[model samples]
Target: MSNVSVCFSWQIFTMESCVLIILVAMPGVWGGAWGVTFGDLCALKGTSVVMNCSYDYPSGYSVTNVGWSRPHYAAASGKWRLFFLSRLPTPPVHFEYVGDYNGNCNLKIHDVQRTDEGNYYFSFVTTLDRYTSTTPARLSVKELTAIVRPSTVAEGDDVSLTCVLGCPARTAVVWFRDGQRVLKPVFQARREDAGRYYCAVLGQETVRSASVVLNVQYAPKNVTLSVSPPRGVVQGSSVAFACASDANPPVTPTAYSLYKDGQFVSAGQSHTVLGVQPSHSGLYRCQAWNNVSWRGVDLMNSTEIRLDVQYGPTYISVSLEPQHAVEGSRVNLTCSAVANPAADNYTWWHKRTDSASSSPGPMLWAGSGRVLTLPAVEASHAGLYVCRARNSVGEMSSAEMLLTMSRGKRGSQPHLIIAGVGGFLSVTLVIALLWYRKQRTHAERKPAVFGSGLGVRGSSSPATGDQLDAVYANVGTSQWSPPLATAAQDAASRSQRSARHEHELPTSDEAEVTYSTVTIQPRNPSFPPRTNNSRAPQKCGIQCLTLMAVDIHGRKRDTLV
Candidate 1:
């Protein structure tokens, strides 16, 4: 066999730089040729790799066989030994020798795995001699992996993600978050950005990095407060309040707080108040917080709510418009109470006290509503008043109030009696004065003729003395006027004179006589003296005068004057 020389050169490109390798054959091997093959090639897992190789020996030498080999550990020799890949009883299905014995020694591997990484050699045998490449090409299997600058970050912070591979190759990278494609690997972190992320080489869809989880921390949001019983919360009933919020680090049970009327009440996610009352009714709110912070504040508050506690009427009482009630006067009674839900119904009751009994009478329904009005209060209205207030829950009655009525305006009996007596005395004095004046005028006209007994003035006999006495007796002394009393005394004096004349005069020549006694009373100083001409015979004060005569034979005659 002739001495031959073999030489080989190849280039390797990587992400950082490119490398060139040349293998020099033994000095005796001259005019031998070897095809350039890749040096130290890199490939991602689950991908395919190809190694280019060819050989040329003396032109007369015919190619017999070609194969590939890899270094392996030999237990018997206790040293490393070469294992022919094609000589194995069952060759690996992933490996294929595409090159033929004519000098092409290319080898291909599919679905590269970490275990397939190692140095590889190509060998060929001809009719005269056999040769193998001295410098072997190395195969490095790498896997795609995702790298994050910060796995956990606060919202609004900047984040960076990268797809890394040990292999040296410039390939376009694609990023994904929760199975959704992302345009950029670096972005501002937000609440939505928190999720699983991965990357892959642009063309290698099957080559994907392990998933990485992103966590975004932020302050509590959407804080809310809820009541177990939203409506119809009455006194003595239990009530519950629940607080909730959305946050990266969920609010702790102890971080919840309750407030009433802007004042803090208690702490806890759920707060319960037993035996609620009207005093508990006010504006309410809840607050929540977590370790996360935003805008210089770590706590958040919910919108205000109203907690209304229902209750029955309390402190019921009645008020009077006019404190004193009198007959025929206007009066008003008003009812009032303190309650959560205002009292809707009002009732007024009355117990009369005007009865003879000292105790109050039975209570009777007086009126309904907040106010009871009496247009004209009377005696019958005098009584004890009570007001009742009612609501949906219960009812209450006010204390009884006594009402007294006074008499209306009217004249007293004593004053009327005095007025009547005074009027009667004034009428009596006026009549007495007029009568006295008339009597005085009549007496002045007659001038009190001193004629004592019956005188015959016109042949008419005057009334006998006995007849005159009988007439005088008919005039009542109680009814006698002041002037008549004096006339009565004068008649008595004239009777004595008539008796004397009867004794002295003869009985044979009987004569008729008419006599009248006229008495004049002193005139009152309030009246002027009357004139004689005013007292003519036609105007005689005496009502009448008469005279009569009798003959010797018992004959009688009549006369008028």
Candidate 2:
């Protein structure tokens, strides 16, 4: 084993002779073909690190010792100390030698401190000469730190994030947000980029910097207004409107304002309308703002909503098809109304003709819409009808409509009576025609009579001239018998009686008398003889029968004719 002294005045010591000597960098102290190679290293504080070093010395000479040390003093001072040496059995505190003393000069430092930041040097002594690296391996002890520019930045603004090491080193810097790596170091900040962030060196990835929180403030966005009761907003109702805004920092109630038809109505996060009226119905909007922008520049307004106020089912009216209905026919009754919220229910009522009250009677039917139907109309259905309509707002009743049976249908009884009379008259006419037919048949069965036989009433044969003279009597008498009126009436009566007697049937002797056996007939001698051109006297409604009789004298005699 060998050891190096601190100064030139110190004695040299050996493994057996106990000789010690000072080793220093002089103009010709390095041996032939001597060189050193090393790379820069980055180490984290409070952790362990290894500084690897290799050196080339005279090839033929046997190797003796190797050691590592940090260059703490100036190069001109020529004062240096060994923190770790392979020749020594034990290293100094916080320093250890874990490499071969033949050529390897690797040194490990435990619990590295920030003050240990410097260049490290490696030295080796051969049997011929001693060598120390001129270009020492540079070592850097860094405490990673995340630097965020403009600690409080507005959202959508460009920002710079950097990972800083206490000392210079040729290592990459990586950034992390929360526990995940942030892909970009410099980018526009957003509200979502607001968590804890840290940084680490490439080699010391587990040793990270202190966390830094990014505060991204922004103006309000996506402002919206909501209503408590969406439908059936009517009078005497309580309605509430709520405003919501999307902002990094919660929007304060003071930032919200409610407007009704472009006019300011209320403030705060919500507005309430208690016992609302028609005046409250209008277009509504809400606006939100924050301190991030100028006044009236970034204020966000919500979509407008139209509020309608419902009132009533006003002016209800009922209509009837075929204003006048007929019995046993179909009738349609329609009930309609005008309302804010259209009618939701309908009811129908009926009143009888005999009912005295003006109001309608019991409910006939209930429905959900406007139309009502009566399948078969009857006389009982002919009366006043009323309709009622109701909705969420209010209820209303329609005016009465009178239903009556048709006029032609009401006089059915008279029509039936006329039909019965016509049928009776037809039956009477048929009976009279049957009796007339029977009388005509009897008349056709009788035998026809021949002229100039014997004049008879209801006799089968006609009268002969001699028989007519014997049967007839002269009624136009010239002898005075009575007053003029009595004689006239008596003459008429005798004339009709004589005509009737001429038709009377005679006995066998009279029936056998012939014109050849009779004497010459003559007119009455007292009266002038009749001339051929003389017209027969006319009686009112009686047929005149002229009769001639022969006397037992050669002179002609005349009888009543």
Candidate 3:
């Protein structure tokens, strides 16, 4: 058996090793090049590495089919796939040449990548390996592409450019940035990846290539932008805008860079107010860049935005219904902040507490702030009212206006106490008079009916009966006392008692009463006692009763002496 082999160090480019050949004669001992060495190669990730294999077969042992594959490292097997004469090379397999079955075979990689490292085998349909099989060919790879770095990037401004490598990491890849060899990463990413980014590649055995271009994408991209006051930004006035961008390095470390009209005005600032108004205004924009990208992107773009200065509503107004209303009268109030373009809106809040309070508390006037149409004004609405006006730019308030709600004119006057009393007295008097008249008539109309043996009589005399009851009952009896009975013959001594009473009744206007005995002493003796007994003696209301004899005044006699 005879074999040829070459050896070299892992990472270093070394001179070719001396070849050695050993010859041996024995049965089943196959002789050929046991080891064909392919040195390590540098290439970018996601690219292919090829191991070209060629061989001469003995005349008696004709060739069958040839195949290439990574039998070991199952995980890397896909990355190191197979190329055969009969089938298309599997995934991770490059392009295959079918003509290899008769003798010629070449493997081509469509897209190369990292991780496709390890041993590869070639096979022929034979008795040994179902015809033929080779040990393996060892190949190594070195990364060829350059690293990229970016420096400080603003939210809306492009950060400076920085890069590690700009060249393809193959054939001794060369790095160049801004037209210079860059051994280390640059500080900032360039726009267009910069006409600046490129690399020159040298051939493994032939001529070198001119620098190639590298297009990079970095963090923080830009979006729409707008302003609250779109007219023209003024000095000492707040200006606002919106910014957005897409980035992997994170837009967090980014800051806003504001350019006024065209000149750099501020940085790391969004809500900006140029305290001092500049004289000009024009084009404006910003870009974002970071070490994450080889080229910078825009975080927020500058739309058409200008700044202008203006004033807001000054004095406000408040009106009360029925301009001349009385206290506690319902007052409709309209408090408005009159200014340019009116107000944005109005909000009304009472100076005091509301229904949530514990007492008869105050409440906010209802309506859209400016007009508070109090359905009904109460005493509570009597106070100072303040009108406030505000815009995106500023806010102002009006002087307080005093609002007085009155309880209108008195509904009706209070009735007099005397009138109330007089009414009650008149009612009482009427009742009294009616009762008196009724009693007098009733007594006069009644026919006397003596009990048992007594008689009944109707006399026209003013006092047919004792007139006592007429005068007494005139005032209406408080207590009606029955007259003392004279003679009640129907009963006992009571009959005489009743009789005396009965005879004592007055016959004429003046009644002659014969007491047991009596004598009269006139105020003037000249005027003798009236001899006409029926002539109604005495004066008014006098009563006369006819009797047997009378003795003298103040005395009762047994006979008419």
Candidate 4:
């Protein structure tokens, strides 16, 4: 009973509630007329808390022992864990009983942790009954922590800052930059934003995390080029070059390269040339690069400088449009030379050759141009020619070229006349012979079919003392005919009859009725020439025919009427 009185009195003192108020408020809610009092408590982690309590017992009930237990929901079924028990010489290390044997109960807990959050109750043992406070004190513990996602990053990158706690309760998170409130949890980092950063819970301003500095790496920029002795460099003089750029984690010489006329020349931040030629006169440029992380992007800067050098002529050449020319033809000769300053003067020379002599002739002073022309060329123009080109730098001559006269048909009118006459005579002879052979073949193919002529179909007697009109008859004949006479005789007879027909001047109808005969001369010596056995003696030839007209006196008119 003494131990119970000591622990219960401590709980009552710490609670600080008046016992008379509870008794008047609730008359029989305590059931056996015993009551308990406990107020809620709130504290921070790593701090201490005091649970003030008070209680009452009915009359004639004796107390024996007092104990404090924690109701935890961690197990399957809720259970109470005894943390402080009276009758022990001293309270547990984390708990201390600080009240007397009266009804004032106060529980002190030191070095509070996050796990110390729950409801606590005080129980006391009496000789007749056991009493425990139905109303427990609710204790809450809070802790503040900070977390940074991806603490290190490059320039122009995004990061997040968060304030966290061991409990699931939501709270406002505040961020700080260089010990100043930023009021935001997300940070869009740039080169200028590289500094110390931290975070804290809003209500617990005193709690914070260790500061972390952000590292921002960036590529090279603001590239520039410089040259020593900026002007007036001779053709064979020396010169120096330098390149530079600005970047974080300062760019090294190995990251720089030099170019001449857009072509890679060397690798370095600086370069020197000992003997610069005119070929080196062009656009010179330098580039700086920093491709860390190589995002498949072009991260580089460049600058350029133009270099001019003075030089003399280096190459000379001569050309001719028509390398071979004929007599009385136009010709052109040109000389060309490559120099820093172009050539302005030119001269021509000739080398003549003959069947008896050859020599380098006098120089022809042409105009101050690159080309020379000879308009009306002749045999005298046949020679070896050369050209000389001159400028401020130097003078050079071209190789010699030999020009000669053309060998083609020129002047022979007599030979042309003779050839023309000979061709005409040969054609005439061929035509005469072809005509003779064609006549002989025609005579052999037509062996002259013999047929008696048919007189007029109806004959009418002429009237007395009347002038009779002449009648013309057209007779049709086949291609076959009878033989007339020997070839020689026929030819003689044809001549005679042609002469007679010319004298007589027969009409068209009578002349068209001329006889055609083809004779086959027998090669046997005994064969004799055939004779005409008709009633009248007719001209027996291929071109002769007898035509007559009879009157009422039966007189034959042998001539055409």
Question: Which candidate achieves the best lDDT against the true structure?
Answer: 1
Error of 1 at 205 (Å): 4.0
**Which 10 residues in a row give candidate 2 its minimum summed lDDT?**
511-520
lDDT of 3 by residue, 1-561 (tens): 021221121111122211211112133455533222233333343445454555555444545445565543235444533333234334633544433644544454434443455455554432221222345655443333333332333223333323223223414545566666666333344443443444444332111223334444455555334555676454456656544455545454246565666676656435444452333334455544444533343344545455444445656666666675454344566666644445786645455433466553344543456666654466665565666667654567666556654464532223346667889999999999999999867754533222222111243333322322222111111122222132222133433554565467555422332322123233454653433223322331111221122223322111110
| RMSD in Å for model 4 | 21.8
Better of 1 and 3 by lDDT: 1
TM-score of 3: 0.28
Backbone clash numbers for all candidates listed = 16, 18, 74, 29
Runs of candidate 4 with Cα error greater than 4 angstroms are: 1-154, 157-217, 225-240, 260-264, 277-284, 290-311, 338-359, 362-364, 379-384, 388-395, 406-495, 499-561
TM-score of each: 0.58, 0.46, 0.28, 0.36
Candidate 2, residues 1-561, lDDT tens digits: the string is: 133333222123244322212321344544357767778877877567888766676667666866676544435667754443333333356777777755676778776777766777776666655656776787788677788986788887887898777655555878888888898988988878888888876666777788998888887878899998987788888999999988867789988999999999888999888998877889999998887763337787899988988978878888888676766667788998987778888888776665566665665653445777877777677777788888887898888888877745433456679988999999999999999999868754533222222333356654344453453343233333334334345445655554454456344323322221122233344443332233454222222222333323322212222
- Cα deviation in Å at residue 497, candidate 2? 52
Worst 10 residues of 3 by lDDT: 5-14
Candidate 4 Cα lDDT to native: 0.61
At residue 448, what lDDT does model 4 achieve? 30
lDDT of each: 0.71, 0.66, 0.43, 0.61
Q: Order the candidate numbers by lDDT, best to worst.
A: 1, 2, 4, 3
**Candidate 4 at residue 154, lDDT?**
66
